[model samples]
Target: MFSTFARIRTLYSSTTFTNNTSIFRCIKTIAPSIDQCSNPFSGKGSCGRSVPNDDYFATIHHVSNIVRRDIYLERTLNKMHISRIVNSELVYRVLRSCCQHGIESFRFFNWARTQHPQYDPTTVEFEELLKTLARTAHWETMWKVVQQMKAQNIPISPSIVSFIIEHYGKRGLIDQAVELFNRLKNFGCSQTTEVYNAMLFALCEVKNFQGAYALIRRMIRKGTVPDKLTYSILVNGWCSAGKMREAQEFLEEMSRKGFNPPVRGRDLLIDGLLSAGYLESAKGLVRKMTKEGFVPDVGTFNSLAEAVCKTGEIDFCIDLFNDVCRLGLCPDTETYKIVITAAAKAGRIDEAFQILHRSIEAGHRPFPSLYAPILKAFFRRGQFDDAFSFFSDMKVKGHPPNRPLYTMLIKMCCRGGRFVEASNYLVEMTELNLLPMSRSFDTVTDGLKNCGKHDLAKRIEQLEISVKGI
Candidate 1:
């Protein structure tokens, strides 16, 4: 029996550990007869010292446990394609079992080196395993696995390089992404537009505009013409750095060469000017947009409105808002939110309320974003009557409270000692089939005690008990 496994292992090495089908057949037979050695090779290689029938029975029983676990965990859960919520310990258990049983585990390095394409070292499905590992944020484990593959001199593909760059970028590890990129280039992975774009986008995210700009120039110097999206990434980086003038120059350069860049280039120019308090400069560009038959989109209007509003020039914002409407454009909820928010910030609460009301009457719905500054302003000025009334109106209009809304309302009620009112709202919540959640209960419980309503607090506690079962 020991001689048989040694021959099998020899056959395995010669075939690069291929699934010959004959090997599994031999294992299926010999595994049940393995009374020979629990410690294969006396403690080292193939088979150990002689043992009895009960020892074989015990080993077979242990193999049963291992096989059962792998079938349920790695084979089943892994086959289901859901890695996140799946118990990682269970996978480790199954892998441990396989490794101990001299089996080729999923965790093993030479998993797919075989004659069959499906079991090939360079197969696409094998690559999917790496992709899944990278995507699931198992970077360390994946790095080790890829390195082991490298130790065997497997050809690392372009898509794998792209995968690494994207994984680091999405995880917001810019330096790690750049490091991986450098490593890829060092390994002679020819740079593609896709690779350059990934690195440029990552730099843009970290506000490393100058670095991204320098890389674009370097790529051009290397005769690797950056794509249109690469240019857009640089423009976005420039907008982040408040260098609207350079962005505009790039845009002009693209236009002169007949390269059609994104419409968002103009939008970024507007944002940079608006953010830097250059209202007139921003407006001049907007006018030029219309002059060039480039209808300013919703984003252009938003920046214009925000810039005008920042100057406490609501009148100009209103004019700009009308222009946006005149162009038959629907402003996003964020744009309307900014209008009211800036007004409320400037203590023009009345104007803010008027805009909010007009927005609603004009077929615009209340967005949760607009409520923050408006809520803070109203609460600061002791305008709960209006605030709670607006709250009621929002619900009646079929808009539900978001997390921030509930948090703000709870705080306001607690500060104002409105326990009775808070408890009443819970009743309303119950009526609407909305359970008073943890936050509600927290507010009410604290509010009642703070207000010296110990009896009411007891009742609220009882109500909590009644609802817990639900």
Candidate 2:
């Protein structure tokens, strides 16, 4: 009997029941073992048998009752209208349950407000509802909720205001975000450093670096001293805008003020410099950061490696990668991938494969991205046999070909007048349910027809239709 209960407890703990209904179902399945009485309150066992007095059984019964109550409330809230004054606690519970179901909480909130003139939701409850609306991107509904809060003379918290500002900025509504930031006081919230940072981020997101700088000046004038984060934001903004000189100037100013820019800020400038073809400048910044006791992370090295590779400086990138390893920073999968790609692009296929072999021996799964450049290089050089051999090896190693890769191969075959191979690839794509883009398909079809393979062209078109149906 004890073993049976132990098994039941293990199952209960391991199972993840998603809803009240699943919980109720689980309870019903388990109840027969513990529910001894025909009447559960009769204090007897099943079939007139005696049962043990165990706390586990009592706890299970209590949990079952809670699940049952939640299920009942969900059904009742959907069907029953609130005619009398409902307690704020009950309203909060219903709102939470509605949120769980992804149902709009506004309807219940409206009903709760009308329940009684004095029945106001607590700030926490209101904030929870606002968060739900924001998460669902129901911006208009969120505004209505805010307006309702204002009508009730409830003070808007800084957290809520910041959330709205961030949301607006994310949606590219820069003007709306700025308007909200400016009206914090009108919303009965004070502008803190958090709000200031949020506004700066919004300004930076829109590439309004001049405005962000002006805002920083205004913050300083208003006695709101800019912190490290403030300087970082300005630096990042200038870097993103391709104004590396301005970014460097800001870093100097930050240092003069006795605050060094953060690692992330430096990384941003390094990325910007590398992207703008200032390789020497980016390397100098890295040396400066190291001199300042900031160890460059793997990401920083990877970014520089990838950027240098793009500029056809494969040897330089390899040396940099070796330096990273010598400094005791382990290269990640992305590091190997970038190096492999660069080697392949430089037509050093043997070196690329050597790196891939080393990475695989190091227990890294060969991702599709790592294979893409090599395959493309082979295809570009008209090495069809080698490309197909590698493609088969990729499948054997559990890195199955994806849609984009298949599309590229098919397009390459069609372009090279390998009509039979193109048709075979098209069939394989259809089997995998990967529909080629219409443009790619049209190109292949036209190529096949021009090559006098009318039947293959028709077959490809038929496969396209089948994929669309799927």
Candidate 3:
């Protein structure tokens, strides 16, 4: 038997053994039958992408479970024929799936490299394992992985470095983050726009505004073009610290230097304020924009409206909606959905109806989600007649109720003690070839029997048995 587990020990002997002894022991124990390994998921479409079959997923689940739970993983895995099917994508996915079991994941990663030449790991696999190690704070092992990457002559990208830096900053290891940022060249990665943005984010996380500002200036002086994200990071940072005026100044200064953001400066400021929970400031900015006839980006308007609506300011959102529309801002379906949902929740049904009509007039088809909340509001107000009429109207207008809608209607009917209506809807669902939930059947039948509608209860029970084939 060409055992993968037996070869893993030799592979480790040839490589540096900086990892713990237990990981080595785990590696030595894995014995896969690589001679019989075959690529069952070798089918490909015209695009040349591997189309994985069910066996691929089963193998993935099997291997991940073994890595996660099996005490003798090598012995268990050695019996499986998985060597040829192992690729970088599979390795990345398995690593991601074993997210909480970092050490075991490492053991599996090491074991995988010894499976076959076909299972040679790539940069994707390395990056994923590095992320797993970093996220689990396995620093020594992470650096050893970096050395392995170096030994393989794979140049580390700035993006992965930035990821590590961000994690370092999050853990308040700012010094480590700065040190890594300073050593980009040693890792053979250029200090690109993405790396600079990440460093700025880290600096701002610790409220080091002055250092962040200097870093951006250094980035610019070094002739690296600042992307929109670079500007947003600083602006958002300032707003988060309640320094709106400084944020505005930074934007203005950047604009003067010919680095205007892709969007309007005020839009960024308002969005930053909203993100920072300075709702009143964000609202104040919107009010100013409304008066100045400046049409904020529809996205900015949507964010502002949605944030305010969450605070029970639907009336204000309504007014803001009208003002922005008058200013020639075309609201997307999401904008209307936000206002309608907020209005419905606040019992402003008429307002919600008006918005829905407008949305329909604008050629937006009313989906179930777009209209379900209105039905819920009507039910809450005990307007059973109106709710039923509205549902019928929606059906007539070409929006057929889905299974979930029927299920919801049935549930609501049962809750309201309208057993007759519930039975009627249950029958309608069967006629439409929709299978009502077992719980729905039980609830309606129980409610019907309690209301002395014994025949209807028997009919519902028969329908349940017929649909479920029980």
Candidate 4:
């Protein structure tokens, strides 16, 4: 029911585009009227300033929406009145956005080619379209695109083949993936390490570990030096299959063969266990590593802490943090963020404050994210005065709160029936040259009126009108 590039000649020959001045007039309206609402910085006010419209993003968004929704895509798109000729970047962006709908993307691509001024779809557009088709399992259409690429003299790169092979593996089309892997040379694409890794991942996806191991050996023999990802892939695969012993042995065997990974195999194991949802095993391994005084990499430790915290084990994560600190692993901001957020959410505001102080002592500047949780915790406990004091202190001492933090504070104030305070924050935002969300204005306006502060509400309305240029 859908048209491909093979039908482009017939489609283009029958269709005609008019330079109707009315059509061009409609183009302005199509350039996204919601730009003002979606981007608060796109209006004529003190707070909301205008910026030049981004034509590429606007065109891609418009074309993608049409392609995704319209069944008769070519017909609907032919009626589109773009003010300027479509470029290669615009074609690629539109194709990328319509990735899940291969046929419609193809139809749109063909339609783009038919546009006046001879729009030539470049290699980039073709490559992105091929990936879109492959990802959507439109194998027939994907092959058609490959043939088109060949005819256009655009050689397929190994990276493109690698992407397709990985997607094939994801979809469990193992045999097809293998066939493509074996035929890369025929496609004039070399067997790069990326291709090997992609093929290895496909084999591993199907639990063909024996085959994956054989391929690794073949990869080494072919003089393609394996990278960290090459080793990590097999380790993660083995861990996923519950073959922990085999995963460890394989890493050791590779190391003994002079193929030592850049990072430690044990770190990979913990990561693999974590990724495979073996949380308890990951925790046990961390404990064992800490006992032997082997300080886990900071990144690995942070990952473990974050994962454990998500399982509502905040206390356990805190203990783990203490253990790692003792091992001289200085926690990064992310480490503090994870713990602070968890502690605040768990109502341990005191503990959250302690972590925030530690972060500051370590010379890390407190951002809104680091401190917002504590504010929220104070509000949750009805410590409104404390939250206000904390906000004031942050403004005077640390990085000034950004637009989002002010928005959060304003909403929280309205929810607590502190309409006057919320209105004050709204005005403060304008003073700081930050554009507040339109809904923030509505909230404060309504709240003030409800509390019989109609005078204050009217002033806020006039301020909003000035800021929004309404």
Q: Considering every candidate listed, which one attains the maximal TM-score?
A: 4
Error of 4 at 383 (Å): 2.4
Candidate 2 clashing pairs, residues 3+ apart or interchain: none
The better candidate by lDDT, 3 or 4, is 4
Candidates 2 and 4 compared: the better one by lDDT is: 4
lDDT of 2 by residue, 54-155 (tens): 422442344323333554533444333332223344455555555533234665566556644555577767887886676567878888888888888888
Look at candidate 4 and tell me the lDDT of residue 457: 82
Report clashes for each candidate as comma-separated counts.
Answer: 3, 0, 6, 0
Best by lDDT: 4
Clashing pairs in 3: 5-30, 5-31, 29-74, 30-74, 31-78, 32-78
TM-score (C-alpha, index-matched) for candidate 3 = 0.81
Q: On a 0 to 1 TM-score scale, where does candidate 2 land against the true structure?
A: 0.51
Off by over 4 Å in 4: 1-24, 28-58, 81-84, 114-117, 445-452
Clashing pairs in 1: 41-47, 41-48, 42-48
Q: Give the Cα RMSD of candidate 1.
A: 19.0
lDDT for model 2, on a 0 to 1 scale? 0.67
Per-model TM values vs. the true structure: 0.51, 0.51, 0.81, 0.84
State each model's CA lDDT, in order. 0.61, 0.67, 0.80, 0.81
Q: Model 1: per-residue lDDT, tens digit, 1-470?
A: 12322322332122111222321222223332223332232433234423333443344344336454564433432333222211222223334444333223443323223211222233333445466566666677667666766776765677777777777777888888888888885555777777888788778778777787778767767777666568766775676677777888877775675655555567767666665566787788887776565667686687677667767787667655656556666767777787788777877787788878877877877766676677777777888778777777776663676655665666776677766666655544443444557777777887788878886666666655555542
Worst window of 10 by summed lDDT in candidate 4: 1-10
